[model samples]
Target: MRGSPAGASFSAAAYLADVFKLKLADLHEGLVEADIKEWLVAEGDEVGEFEDLCFVMTDKASTEISSPVDGKVLKIYHPEGSTAKVGEVLVDIETDGPVAGSEAEAAPAAEPESAPEPAAAAAPAGGAGGEYDEQMITNAAGKSRRVPATPAVRGLARKHKIDLSQVAGNGKDGRVLKGDILKFIESGGAEGGLAPAAPQAPAGGAARAPAAVVPGESRTEKVAPVTKAMIRVMEEANAIPHFGYSDEITLNSLIETRLRLKPVAEAQGIKLTMMPLFIKAASMALTEYPILNSSLSGDKSEITYHGSHNICVAMDTPDGLTVPSIKSVEQLSILDIAAELNRLQELGAAGRLSRGDLEGGTFSLSNVGNIGGTYLSPVIIPGQVAIGAIGALRTLPRFDAEGNVIPAKVINVSWSGDHRIIDGATMARFSNVWKNYLENPDTMILNLK
Candidate 1:
């Protein structure tokens, strides 16, 4: 064999010591793949350990993905708007040596706070919690730093020529929230002769922009990720045979109970709503009829009876509809459930819910009453066997035991169940049990652990 000469073209790649394949790991349960929303870095860019490389949008939530090593990105396997599956390589990087960042970064973002009771354990990922703070990065120059802010906030800052670093952050972990930037600009906080933001017209007198209209004009648009996922889930849900059950229940006792508890909850900085009460009663009812909290496997050969009552509540958010579940509602007190509900609702409104908050739902409840719906045929989520929709409370005259007419507070309830798993009789019985808990708050209180 002849020795290879310098001009013979020995591959330089052979001399490269460490090439790291950054595979997409399991960020949360049931996360098969994530749509890459945007890439923060490009090929040949050097990334610091734990620096975010991209943001991914799953069916229920969006999260940032970080690099696990101090390395230079050799190639990006998935571009923005591409779907990458779990265990698939996301990027290839040339690293210096063994990196310790992978293990810590792969785990799901920890909840900011813990629930008081063990059952109401899942916490919401909201605001500028530690998760967003971790995304703050140092620039390539290693002198300037990137502040943690949403794209909208950054754009607003750019439009005003305001430096985000100079703005004070009041969000969790000192992340620069959009409101903070607005306040900074409004207070004339910009330095170095940057132009102030344009003044707004007086509140009630501001002129509205005229709506533009063009006959026979149309444009095509892609569905948003959240909306697309919801459509896909609904289509899959439509495959299951469904049956509806309806009833009207007196909510007078439940109303009184809430009125009594309102002051207590308010004193403790929690908003007392009927949702926590509904969730509590449903969880209690689930104990007697576990089938309602069960699911059928894909092949329909096996049934899974979940131990905990992970009840999901459908939320109508600014982006779209989201159903984030409250974990183990069975073990939580009404107050505890109220706290968890508050946490989830806030996060859901801001579109900051974690996958953990959205997964492991065994049953669902949708309160259309808040939005003025009288009744709804709520759809069952794919994995869950049943769902309930509640209508607005209305007062109606009913005959008393003495044959005298009396005004009663009532609400319409509609139930949708997987016909394959739940029969009409079982559904009726479950509804009665749940209704009993609400009609008599004392019963629910006595049964509470």
Candidate 2:
């Protein structure tokens, strides 16, 4: 019943539940999503408190989620190979008794045999008063935060002009039940009683993203063969130790250089583009910072500094995301690189790339510029040391040394590197070199000749 008491009258011996959700492990701090590798325990399997239940794959790494109670798994909301947002329910463990020293308050004593069907793990889409009615919101920081409560509870809340997130939950796992909302309104809410948005931080650290509370819905989809392959590759890449850095670089000189060369290259029936320019500059920087063009062994015991700069460019194709590298970028001139890129892009668009086109990549570049993205954290392919995300190039007004406001073509580049070997300063130094060549292509042009 919507807005009903915590434990409504039901048959005795009803089994209560302790829900376990996929959350960010200590090792995975910035990750917001993960995929269910597989369910270790199948539905109907009995489990103990704090027991390993399933493996989840994240961009950061893979980890196992443990059960929080001693009970039989009553339901499995999410199946294998499905993506789940952080804080989404992974499993529901039904227990005859309360969890060992659980912090969650029991919804009064109910009929033990009347074991209510586990509350739908997620809010139904637009089902106001359905089995699982909840309203979802994405905060200013672009994160989906779900507020858990039934329709009537939410209506009562709106009538009193209350923000549900501010109200504390007294039901199972601190869920804000209808009664909790009424109690909050009865306590003179909004007058002096709204909880702040940002959760309190530790004694000496910056506040972390608020712990997600709502269990997100999990939908299953049949992936194509290419998508399956891509998923496997991406999951393998997820184990890499990733660290991100971003910088705004001016592209005025590069833009001018390209404008002059565009006609020269077009005369030969070749379409010169900015991507080849990025690859060229990145290759130059990789020559000096060889680690950026290197690969680590499976155990990370050794690093192989590749001499041939095979710069792979990530592209989205109808089949899936494909990365085709231009072989020996260091040996090719910018024009030659551009022609190769054009060939690969056409092949990608036509879905005709060969295995060779997708292999032997030492480094990667992702251009979100075409899509008008200012910056992105591009995923580094497994084995490669680094990948850079190219932002949209824009002419923004910037103040000069003389305090004169002048228009400057700027681009934001975001780099993610293997933190285990390439430290932040090293990545920053390499980025600075790459940015130098792009910002002043004349220096790179001298090397080309």
Candidate 3:
């Protein structure tokens, strides 16, 4: 049987010879359900145990599956997008020799008294301290830990394509956690080595590295690559169905209410914003029409309702738009909401928002109106059922009950709902409730109880 290489895929024959007692002939097959990110080895190539065979796509992300043994590639069960479920053959490897039983007779047997040694132990390795040491460290820590960080941390580093080992660890047992990794990543890691050293000066008291000069070259231009998050967000937005709705809201009284609350907010060192007011109004509306605060299942089997009102606030960043949610907005007062929103917005702009900030939002609000837009039909975020777009406030003439034309501060509020879950009447009711709350801002502030 062939020996499997570390980080490469192998056949069942290789597993039996190097790692396990079971033969390739005994194992079942499976199919590939999604696109492969990349193949670890080419076709007709030999693979060893524990090598990454290929990466398969899941709904949220892609995962790499390893080979169980070392063997030659005989067949690939399915092309990309083919359904791979239980008991399906994936790839077949040419076995070195015949096993003890016929193919048809190979069935379930009694459990062995002891499990076989891991195939990684027998594979030839490569790297800094020899392949064996790398394998030992990798296997002992598991791929993620051995890789020295979480996918998020690694992705952040990779956005800059920075190395993890070069960063100092500040986590448990000197292990690198997300925060430590991020700090190092943001600072571009160590200067010359793992530890800081005394500064050295050049002959003429210069401390900077000598700049290189290219003959006849005038200038150099550098371009940064896009981040994975940015790619995923754009793809998801483009691929998903996004519907929008807009309504003009009279914010004259809402603005007045903020003025009244200003003194109190200032006393508490909290700057007031319209966001918390919107959040309050939206939360009230969602309580009356719960379906608007839900998510559609991919299969459309059912709408998942959320008990908490985690309102996602869309903020503009240098990279792109990011929505960091204020969890349980229903439980927060106007002042509390304002403070939290301020902190979240700051963290978001700084590119320091945690994963928790970016996920599990029951609803979202995008206030492009702050930037001078009168109205916009905000796109419904994929996986989320609804998103509201708040537009700029403008003084528009309106007719009163007595037919008198009066100037009113009108703000456009657009609610984009998932057609799969919310109906026209439901959406209209939600909007009306929200509009009522905003127009009567006194009700929200006075009725905080």
Candidate 4:
């Protein structure tokens, strides 16, 4: 059977008849690459159904493929450097009982080798053993054998020109692992018998050597590296016409209300903050203006409306930026949103967010204000109609109904919407509703239910 969508939970196929052998399934189609993140079970180790077998890189993100049946791994297909294409066998697994599935037909095994004549051995390389030895030497023992290492370990060795034979392998059966190579490199064991020497100032001169300069006639063009996610986001945003709306919200009442709820939240062992309030307000605003919660199809032929408010919270990870969704934000209370937000943030920062956490977002919220930005026009995430940016709250003087100026905590909210689905008037109306809810914290609490 084919693999399911990236986020959906999937199980392996059932057992088949005749105790057929199970093969390692390829997760993606490409050149076979070996950089297995985890081995579900070791050699002769038994694994249950739906167990995580291994994670492999697919020129994209690392993905985990699960075991299709309960079995023991018989053999690994590639010995680290070998690459395989999609649907190619990865490993051999031995099943206990009858194997499941119609794909259990036995394949023909290799023909038995015949004995070679003594005269053939005298003549250079005429026997079956001669051919096998030649092929093994060429394919396995040539230049590649000198670097019998895992992909990550080989990468480190090449980066520093380290000889694998010089580094001790701590992996199973003396195989070189990344950590072993790294430790060797760090301790200078792989430095070609030369102790790293410190550089001295230029001989007979107080100043350092002159800096190198490029030729004047040579023209150099600067190009920035863009990630896959960034490319998709920019392509969608530029291709789609966007309508933006900005509004300033008075945060004075909101701040006071949070302060009042703080003690109660603390007593209940929950933290009360502006984020939960903002999420609640945004959820309410989404209900009032459901059009803002919909996305435009690529052909502009249809608009897709989502029933649940899967709000994507923009988070910064060590790898890059990631937006993990808080499923059903509309159903969560202020305290519940706070707890979920904290949990998601923690998962996102640790780079432990699963595929489900990153998919199916109907709307996104980016709190750039946390980094000191007062306002920002965030790019619209692909497949999502709108993205809201929250700015830092600051004290600003504003006139009240009495026409008297007073200091208030003012926050900036910027919304970028797909013009194909949401018009300027509709976006402005949505922003107005958000502003109203945020300004009146009491209304936010009432509407949250």
Q: Backbone clashes per model, in order?
A: 0, 11, 15, 8
Best to worst by lDDT, what's the order?
Answer: 1, 2, 4, 3
Candidate 1 C-alpha error for residue 279, in Å: 0.7
Report the candidate with higher TM-score, 2 versus 4.
4
Model 4 lDDT, residue 438, Cα: 78
In terms of TM-score, which candidate is strongest?
Answer: 1
Candidate 4, superposed: residue stretches over 4 Å from native: 1-226, 263-272, 397-407
Query: Could you say which candidate leads in lDDT?
Result: 1
Please write out the lDDT profile of model 4 over residues 69-169, one tens digit for every residue. 45677766655434444445556667665643444222111112122111111111111111111111112223222222333234345445666666776
Ten contiguous residues with the weakest lDDT in model 3: 116-125
Residue-level error in angstroms, candidate 4, position 346: 2.5
Q: What order do candidates take by TM-score, descending?
A: 1, 4, 2, 3
Q: In model 1, how large is the Cα lDDT of residue 448?
A: 87
What is the TM-score of candidate 1? 0.65
Of the two candidates 2 and 3, the one with more favorable lDDT, higher being better, is 2
**Residue 165 in model 2: lDDT:** 71
Runs of candidate 3 with Cα error greater than 4 angstroms are 1-230, 238-240, 446-449
- Provide the overall lDDT of each model, using Cα atoms, as 2-decimal numbers: 0.70, 0.62, 0.55, 0.57
Per-residue lDDT of 66 in model 1? 56
Q: Model 2: what TM-score?
A: 0.51
